[model samples]
Structures are given as C-alpha cells and as structure tokens.
Target: MDNIKLFSEPIADATPVIELFDVGMHYDSGEEILSDVNISINKGEFYFLTGASGAGKTTLLKLLYLAHPPSRGHIKLFKHDLHYKDRDAMAKVRRKIGVVFQDYKLIETMSVLDNVALSLRILGRSEKYIEKNVPSLLHWVGLGNHMHNKPATLSGGQKQRVAIARAIVNKPDVLIADEPTGNVDPRMAQRLLHLFKELNKYGTTVIVASHNTELVNTFAFPRLHLEDGKLIKYNAGSIWTLFDKKGDVNV
Candidate 1:
C-alpha cells in the first residue's frame, strides 16, 4: 500500500545503497517474524541494527542479504527492487554486498588464503587479483602470516579476522554483518570496529546487527531497533505507525 517496492534503478551514479518499503516476513506454523519495515540507507552511511535475542535482527539481515524474500513488502538494494529477482540476478547484486555471519562461517577445510580467495573468486575475479589483495587485507586484519594455515588453527579473534577479510575482499557496496564481534575478546572487538570504521570511511555502506548497546551508543550513527517483529527508531518508546492517506502502511 506504500511506495516501498524494492527495485534497483542503477547506481552507476551515486544512489542509495538500501531501501526497504513496507517489508514483512513470516514463517510456517505461523508467527510473523518481521512486519512492515521501511528504511533507507544511503552511501557511506553506517547503521547499527540493535535488538535483544530473537528480536528478528538476524532475520532482517538475512532479508537484506537476499537469503529470503519479504513475505509481503518490498526489499531493494542498490536502488533496485528484489522480491522477484531471479537467482542469477540476485547473485549478481549479491556480489557487491559482503556478509559476516556471527558464527564465523569460515570454511573449515580451506587454508586461510584459499578461504579468503574464495570470496573474490566466486565473483569471477581473477586469481592474480586475489593473490595481491588477500595478503594486504589479511595483513590489515592481522592475519598475514596465517594465510597458509587452516582456519582450525587460529584463535577466536584470528578466525574472525579471516571472516572479516573474506567478507570485505570484494569491497562490496554494502557490508551486512551479524554480531561480528561476538566471538572475540573486547580488545579485538574494538580493533575490528575500527577496521569496519575504516571500511565505511572508504565509502562502503556498513550495517552491523548486534546486541551490543554500549558499542552501538559509542558511535553516533542512526540505529534500527526491533522487538517481537516490530521495528522503530533506535530505543524509541512506541510502536511505529503510519498515518498517511495511503492506508496505514503497516509498520
């Protein structure tokens, strides 16, 4: 009922990186997980997605990453609508978006170099390019010498470093990370936050989903808060409402 259908209009010029209009999601056996969400994130903006456990924070990240279509609303990325986007089309768009999962989803069987290269190679990037980039990136994350080792050999923070490098190698338009620091020590977490800040400084739109309020508040960017599948401006005291003439748009 609102104008939030997600369709990318092309970002060859500067354009909003993400836009959600009247989006919602539900699962079988029947509870609504996310309902009527609307947000617009522009280039170089950093946002934190904050909510307690089971508040649908991760689920919303899944939607942004195109893991699932919204049940009723539109989801757009790079200015394009995405609800009916085909597998290949979606993959193309996804190539420009990086994701860091809370679980540190590094491939256990691969060497660190191989794992990091996998990200770039998946996007059809040349091996020569990956060879040059992975080392510098890993170095930035403090993993330069560990490239030949398997992920199993690294400590929690080291493993996280690998995940971060892999997620960012492509310099995607947007980086969506879920609890990226959950597995690291506080010191390492701070370091990684600075690294992400550096990435955002380089013009990557950054969205971090986490329960770390102290950290969220430490930075001044706007945040999205969710509870029981409903969303509102960060830490606000009321449910979102729509009073426009177009019928309550359901947020």
Candidate 2:
C-alpha cells in the first residue's frame, strides 16, 4: 500500500474525477465480488482495467457509471458523494458520463443515426440540432454512409463504431468502455484506441476495461489490476505491467 501511495500522488492542483475508498460489492448469495478497493482517477487521465473474467471488472465499471450502489464504502464522482440518493442530482451526474458496453447496446429497431442521436433527443434538443450533429459524428466514426442502416445490418466493427459515436455525440466529460475492442481485428482495435486517445486529448477522462493483454501493453497506459474481485495493483506511471500473485512481473 505504501508503494501504491508512492506512485499515485495526485498531480499538482488537479482534482480527481473519480474516487473510491474501501469500496466493496457483494451479491445476495453472500459472495463478495470486490473488496477494499481504493482509487482516484483525475481528469483527462486514461486507465486500463485489466483482469480475468469474473474478476469484477464489469461490476466495478457499473459502480463508476452509477448503475449500481456499492454494498459498502464510498464513491465520489466529479466531487459529489454517491451516498446522496437524490435522483435529480444523480441524473445530472450521469449526464456527464458516457458508457459503451461490449454488446453495443443499440436498439435493433432504430437506424444508426437514430441510435446515435438518442441522447440528444432525450435532452429535448431540436430536430434541427440533432440532424446537424448526428451525421457529423457518424462520419467521424467512419459510419457516415451507414447512418440509415439498422444495428442488425452492421458488421461487428461497424456496430462498435456506432456505439462509440452514440456515446460521445453529447461530448460527455467521462467515457467508460467495457471490452470495447473485444470483437474487432487488431488493426481496428488500434484505430478505436486512437479515437479514445483523441477524446482524452480533448479532456475527457477515459477508462477502458479489457483483458486484451497485447493491446493493453501496446498502449502503455497506467493500469488498475483486479484479481478475485480485489484491486491488487495500481500503477499510475510508467509502462503497464501485469504481476501475478507470486509477485512476478509480466511486461
């Protein structure tokens, strides 16, 4: 823990965008999914959540986007404590965080353009505004020609791109991606990462949960490593490294 402190001192004058203290989650079956997790992710930073299947990566992500409340401990996002159960306050916070799921949770019945514009539409933006922005965002994600196509008609990569376009169309302050490159080719995966990097450069905090070691290593982002539902390692600087329980490092 001291070593973690040594490497994780916050940047001067920068406030953390997300903070978790002794966070834990468990199920009705009394099975612990996460325990004693502590982390702070500052604005504009990028991190890879690397762990095996069932290591609670998705659960932890759910906590970030406010999909679920932790069974214990505290979580603060954008400087607001999640302990406050005010619906209006929570909704306001959620409006600033965009999430991209692994399944590309687009509406199968809606056209790609409609799906991408859903957020703005819900916000009561005018059709004129939606019309102007959706296509441009689609074009940026390489889906310009496919805007009218339904999710059922798009390829895996195309669907992922659509998901990304939808998530960022409103220009949220934080973007959370779960296994974003899971179904794409390596080249497309890198392209997707490049997109995230570009967004990060524009000041969006990005957190990607993935098990793809090659991509994780290649990107050289700081990492939060989970094991058996516990955050065992947090490296905020230097190249990413995976360490086993025996303390053997894999670079």
Candidate 3:
C-alpha cells in the first residue's frame, strides 16, 4: 500500500459507500443536467441505472466516481465528506473505487496482461506481486491465453472483459460500469452482465447503466431510471412505467 494515498483526515466509523444529498450539476454555460439527486449506495449493493441517451446517467456516475464535483449539495463516501477533502484525498478515495467507461479505455499498444497490470504498477506494487496477479486475473476474465494480445486483436466482448478485469484487478470496494454490454452480441452481453453479478457476489458494490431493456429485464435488481435530469424508481411488471411527461426510453 505504499503508493496508495492515505486520507487527509480519518473517518468517524459510519458512512454509506456513497451518499448524495440533494446533489445537482450545472454547467458553466448555465445548463442544469442534474437536480436534487439524493441517494445512498450501501456496501455490497447491486443497482442498475437505465435511461435513454443524455438522460444524466453518465453524469451521475461521474460524480459518484469522483471524476467531477457536483455544482450543488454534498457527497460523502466511506464516511469521508468529500467537500472537506483535497485533491490528494480524492485520489485515495478513487483507489477504492473502480470504473468502466462505455468507451473501453484500454491502452491499445499494451498487451492484455500489461494493460490490466498497469494500475497495480501505479500503486507501486512489487514486480513479483504484479507478475503473480496480472496473469491470474487475465485468466479469471478468460483472457489468460491472450495475455500477449492487444486490444485491437480482441473481439468486442473480449475487450469488455479485459476492461472489467483491469477495473477489478486492484480489488476495489466498488465498481461502476456504463454501457458495458453495448457493443457485443446478446449472448455475449449476457455473459458480461453475469460477470458483474459475480463481482457483486464477491462483496463489491456494483452499479451498471444501460439503455438495454431486454437485457436488464432478465434480472430482478432495483433500477434507477433517469429522465431529462429527473430521477425515477423502477419496479416489477414493467420497466417503462416512468416515462410519463418527464421523458421516454424506447429501450
């Protein structure tokens, strides 16, 4: 844990994994994207967030992942009030969190194993430790034989799995995935979803966002629906019950 940053201040022993209190986001050009978003993601919870394009799902994820600060309200994670933390402290928080963007942000030049092991190296893990962990994780994600292969050489589903393995390699307490199954076939997409489910079973708080109705409908997890910067809850029988007057998602 040498490269892992220590918190600037210690926590008082009680806090949700993530707590957003009336949080909102406003752009510099006077556009409001999120308004009064108050939610708490407890430890080891699995949640799905689905909405149409530009419905603020990604924005909400960005805030939760600490990519950017909200324009209004407070965010607390692991009992650490983010408002009181500096940049250094934020980095530490990020270390315990893992994220998978829709774009599959992999190093095209690096082999699958190398790319997956990059994060551990960044955290100053010993060479022996990284060597032991990298191949093991690649195999876990079904990429062990392809360790020497780069991203461009892999299939869309394979790339997604590589991204997932990289995200979880550090053993983060939480994982956030945005449109992780968007580019693959239905069967492959289902496989990827199962990977997320398996990760959750291992005690990682998991949140996934996708506009894929058929895909999400197969699972009985709670869903957070978004529309025109507004939020709605998803329940049984139908996932499309929240598109009234606010917004609609065809998927």
Candidate 4:
C-alpha cells in the first residue's frame, strides 16, 4: 500500500454535502424506523454511524443514497431539496453517490473484474478505461489474483472487497457503506478504512455504519449514534492526529 495522507486541510468554506431536517421513516405497518432525525455532513467529512442491530443505521443510509424516501420531513443533497418526486433528477443525484451494501450484492455469475467494473460501465466509460483501472483497483484491495473468478467462488471477505471496488471505481462524490468490514479480518478492515480515508482526502464525504465498537474507537472522527430509531449523540472532531500517535497503520 502507498503512504497516502490520512487527512486533508479542512474546507474553510464548508458546504453541506448531506442535510436532513426532521427526517422520519415509517414502514407500511406503521412502524417508525427513524424519527425526527436532523444532521448535516460536510464535504470531506468522515463519520461513523454506530448503533445496535435494528437501530435504523441502514435505514438512515438508505435515505442518503435515495433508496428510501423519507416518510416525513426534508432531505437535501448537494443543496437541493428532496421533497418532490422526480425520477430523472433522483437518478442523476444517485450517480454521484456510491454505496456498499451489507449483503455485498455482487453478481454471482460475473467474474470479479466485471463485477468491480460495473460502476464504470454504467457511467459509459470505455472498455479501455475499465481494463486499465479495474485490475489495479482489485490489486489494491487484495483481489487481483481472483479477478477471473466468480463471486460465488470467493470468500465473504473477498466478496466484500469486490463490492467496495465496484462502489468506488467511479470515484463518487459521496460514499455510504453499511457494515463494510463485517466479514474482513482486523488488518483488512484497517486497510479498507485507509482506502476510505484516502478517498475522503480527495473530497468524498463518507458515512460508514458499523457495529464494530473497537474499530470505531480506533479513530477519533465524529460519530452518529442512534438508539430507538432516533439520533441520540453526535461528536465532531478530528481523529487523524490521535490515530497517527497511536497506530502504526501503513497508509
């Protein structure tokens, strides 16, 4: 791995990358999954969404990625109000966000290279570009040797890496990951975090939902804590200096 800067200079003119105003989500069964949620994440900010199982961490991420519309209240992405229903507009907005789902969601029938290259392909990138970058990205994620294998043939950790590669290949402006390190080993989890941190340095706002408390404590980034379908705690600060002093992480 290369020695990439873990943190970039803070943006003095911080722009809201994601904003939620009294956002709420409820199911058809009248069960509320999220309630009165209000939060704002700025460009280049990295946050960990920590909560217990069924605490609505995934629900919140779904709202940001435009997967689930808020049952009530407002959501603003890149400063645009998200109150109206506009398929074309939503599709355009979604193109700028990358998501790594907990299920990995890899195509079992496709080779690892093709699976990781799907994002670039959907963006109409040329085959030449995919060929040039996908392999290198796979190598970076420790999946280079398995590029020709199908997802079903890979281990849980390998599939997770492939999903990560696919989500980030196009360099989306915002990245949302749900339990991205759940299946990987501790070392690999650190590596994945480093990748996300590197991307953050390049101006990508990242939100990672995880149940790994130990991993969360390793970084000093602000945390979004939810309980009983509501955001109960939020801390804002830099964890870079602390991490530099405490860990010998490469890149």
Candidate 5:
C-alpha cells in the first residue's frame, strides 16, 4: 500500500475539486429533481449526502459522477466546466473518480481478484502490477482468503467489500459510495465507515450517501441534506439546529 498511492494527493490550496452552480435536473416529463443546487466540495474533504428515499440523493450523485448532464446550469470538475468538456475531456476527468454503486455491480463471471483488478487492466496496468497490488488490496478489505471466489459465493458483506475494493483499487481522487453499509450489520457498517475514513486521511475526497441516520449521527462530518428538490449544506451541529428551527442554508 505504501508503494501504491491508494488515492491521489491533493494540491495545496487549490480550488474546490467539485462545484455546482444553479444546477437542476429533471426527467423527460420535466418535473425537477434538483433545483437551484449550488455547492463546492474541496479536495480531500469527506461529506455525507443524506435525505429520505427519492429525495434525490442518487440523482445528485449521478451528477457528481458525470453520469448525466444536468437539465440546466453549470458544473465544474477539477476546474473544467462539464458543459463544455468534450467526451474525451469528460472521460479523462471521470477516470479520477471511483464510484461504489449500491447494487455492488460485481461481475459474477469473474473471480474476486479479477473483479477488483478490472480497473487496473482497463488503465493498461501491467499484469505484474495487478498481481502484486490487487491481492494486497483484497487483503486490506479482509478478502484475502476469498480472492479466487466468484461474486455468487460471497456473503452480502463480502460482496460489498469486493465492490469497495474495486472502487479504490485505482486510487481515485474522489470516492463516491451510495449506501455502502446498507446491506451489512451494525458492526460491519462501522468497519466500512472506518475504511472510508482511512481513505480520506490519505487525501481522497469522499462522498457517501446514506439514509442510516443513526450511523450518520455518530460521525462528525459535514452533510449535504436534500429535501424537496433543494440542498441544505451544514456541519454537524448546524444540522440539529436547523432541524429544530425548520430552516435551511445553501452553504
């Protein structure tokens, strides 16, 4: 792990790595999903995206991950305006982001090692590099003994770990996880959060989306709370204070 950077090192005092200004998204029917969303997430910060089901948590993540363009407004990734970046330009930035889908998105046909190694393979990493690092990463995620197993054979928690291993294997600058702990027990959930915390300490900007309020409350990270198509960005204590007053702040 020391030889390989598990995440990119942040530049000192640079602009926010992610920025959204007057962003909005809607379906073909034109009902807005996100409205007037504006926020800036700096490099190496950890944030939790929280909201009720269908409160646009996933939608917001899609925008961050460059899954789709917003129906309107501007987005900047690493200081490149998404609206203007061509396909290749956008892809160049996208590679720096690692996403852990809620569904685990593993290839059942592939062994756990290969599943985790696919990103490296795609990036043209040498087989030797893959062999050396992939197994080591799997071990870090507590999957050392199961590297040869396929996805179908893993327990829910194990599969989640595989997904996480795959996401971080390429050392993405930004790591986005949607309900990463949703399938695991309380103990495992805490363990998984600790892993994310460790990644943040190594300079990866991490954004985790979760509805598990109890788990979220235990952490002191700032939060981006979405409600009724708007965003409320607040720190730990600010959320409780805002909840009591039934108020919201953009920043």
Candidate 6:
C-alpha cells in the first residue's frame, strides 16, 4: 500500500484512465478469482497482462471492459465509478473502450469489411466515410483481398487480424486485447503489435493480456502479472517490482 502511494505520488498531474482499488471477483460456484487487486493505468500507457492459462487474466479483462461487476471493492474507468446496474451509463462508457476477445467474436454471417466497419457504423458515420476508410484499414492489416469474405471463409490468424482491425477502427480512448496474437505467426504478430504501438502513440491506452513470453519480451512495456489472485506491477524486462516498497516505480 505504501508503494502504491509512492508510485502514484510522482504522477499527480496525470490521471489514471483505469483504476482498480481493493477489487475482488467470484462466480456462482463461490470460487474467488481475484482478490484485493489495486492498479492505476494512466492515459497513453501500454501494459502487458501476463499470467498462466487460468490465472484470472480473462476474468480481470471482463471487469476492465465493463462486462462484469466486481463482487467487492471499486473500479473506475475514465473517472466514472462502475455501477453495474446502470446499463445505459455502462454502455456509454463501453463505447469508449474497444475490446478484442480471445474468441475473436466475429459475426460469421458478416463480411470482413462489414465487421470492421460495424464500429464506425454504430457511431453513425456516413456510408461514404465508411467506404473510404475501411478498405485502407483492412489493407494495413493485410486483409485487403479478403474484405468481402465472411468469417467462416477465413483462417484463424486471418480472423484475428479482422478482430484487431475492428477493435481499433473507432480509435477509442482505451483498447483491451485478450490473447490478440494467439492465432498469428511471429511476423504477423509483430506487425499487429506495431499497429497497437501506433495507436498508443496517438493517445489510446492499451492493455494486452497474453501468455506469450517471447512476444511480451519483444516490447519494453511495463507488465501487470497476476499470481494467486493478487496483482503485481513490474518494470519492463526486469524482476524489480514497481509496486513494492524496496523497488522504485519507473513506469
């Protein structure tokens, strides 16, 4: 707790885009998934969420993306406290956060272009604007040739690319990706990361949940590691703790 104060004290001028304080979660079976997790992610920062297969990574993501409420404690996104009962308010805040699920969650009936264009469409953009920008974004993700193809016709990696393109098209205030690179080759994975990097440069906070150590090590972003239902923030590429009293917070 002292270290949380230390880490937060130096950055008083900058507000956290996402804040979790003494948060905890559980399911119907009465099993606790996370406990007392405290974290604050500032604007424009990129963090890699790393842990084992069932280490509550996805569960934590569900909370961050505003899909579920914590069983205890508090969560604030974009400075608004999460009151899960307020569906309208939750939906409004959700629109400002883009999420790429582990399952891709694409509509099998829709074409690649249509899927990627859905976000812009929901925002009520004109057809002309959608037509002009969607193709260019698809091409950037190397899906130019598959714009008209449906999700059922594409491979796993291709579907993942489509999901990435869609999540980022609206340029939301924050982007959350769950195992975003799981289906792609190393080359394509790096390319996708570069895209996320470009978006972060433009002021979008990014959090990528992954178990891929090689890929995580390739970037110098600070990491939030989940272990035994607790959270620890660490400096990039080091064992030095960011939220422990003995180590300094460099992120």
Q: Pick the candidate with the highest TM-score.
A: 5
- Candidate 1 wrongly placed segments (more than 4 Å): 1-14, 83-85, 235-251
Q: Write the per-residue lDDT of candidate 6 for residues 1-251, one digit (tens) a residue.
A: 01111011112236688988878888799898887787878888899998898899999999999877899989999899988898889988998898988789999899999999988888899999899888877877778899999999998788988998898787678899999888788887887788787667667789999899899899999888877676767677579453543221233
TM-score of each: 0.85, 0.87, 0.87, 0.86, 0.91, 0.87
Give the Å shift of residue 237 in candidate 1: 16
lDDT of 2 by residue, 114-156 (tens): 9999889899999998988788778777888999999999888
lDDT (Cα, 0-100) at 177 in candidate 3: 95
lDDT of 3 by residue, 36-131 (tens): 777777777778998899889999999999888899988888878895448788889999999997889999999998888899989899999888
Q: Give the range of the ten consecutive residues with the poorest summed lDDT in model 5.
A: 240-249
Instruction: List CA RMSD, all candidates.
Output: 7.5, 7.8, 6.6, 7.0, 3.0, 7.6
Q: Which candidate is the best by lDDT?
A: 5
For each candidate, the alpha-carbon lDDT, in order, equals: 0.77, 0.83, 0.81, 0.80, 0.85, 0.82
lDDT of 6: 0.82
lDDT score at residue 120, model 2, on the 0-100 scale: 95
Clash counts for the predictions, in order: 7, 0, 0, 0, 0, 0
Worst ten in a row by lDDT for model 2: 1-10
**Model 5, range 150-186, lDDT digits (tens) per residue?**
9999998899999999999988889999999999999
